[model samples]
Target: AGYNHDADTKAGILSACGIEAGPDDAVNLNNLDDWQEFYNAEIAS
Candidate 1:
């Protein structure tokens, strides 16, 4: 299920739902601008 969507996609969902994300959050899937970074970090780690 987690693989079904990228982090940015999930982040978009969170944004749509008015969810407030903390700044320290490493995986900013909602942030389409940074999903690639998060994806890369996860696979590498």
Candidate 2:
């Protein structure tokens, strides 16, 4: 569902909902790989 939105659009949607994110931050998880990357990064942190 989120595949059609670009990074900027995703960021804008988050911003409108009061979720602030930096330019380099990922705004959506598009697939299992994306979720895995996010999970690994969080675990590392």
Candidate 3:
């Protein structure tokens, strides 16, 4: 199983972790659909 959160929620989590988003943080949500796609492709391997 996997976890999912909206962009605003994600930003809050990251901020709490002392991580900030920048220009490199841009995500192609229209093409990729959701966070699970990123997790499976980038993190779950």
Candidate 4:
């Protein structure tokens, strides 16, 4: 299984937005449920 708090994934999240991650920025993609929520929010935005 993938890591819940992978550094590579965090880096990807930062790159996705084309900006550096702030102090409050965090990626907690721990499971499919988390992915679904994040995907839905991104689509909505």
For candidate 3, the lDDT comes to 0.49
Report residue 18 deviation for candidate 3 (angstroms).
0.5
Candidate 2: tens digits of C-alpha lDDT, residues 1-45: 223556776666555444565333334423333555565689746
Clashing pairs in 4: none
Per-residue lDDT for 1-45 in model 1, tens only? 233455675566556545655332434443643554565578647
Give the per-residue lDDT digits (tens) of candidate 4, residues 3-44.
344567765655555446522234343333355557769975
Clashing pairs in 2: none
Model 2 residue 31 lDDT score: 38
Off by over 4 Å in 1: 1-4, 21-45
Runs of candidate 3 exceeding 4 Å displacement: 21-45
lDDT for model 1 comes to 0.51
lDDT preference between candidates 3 and 4, better one: 4
Instruction: Quote the lDDT for 44 in model 4.
Output: 50
Worst 10 residues of 4 by lDDT: 22-31
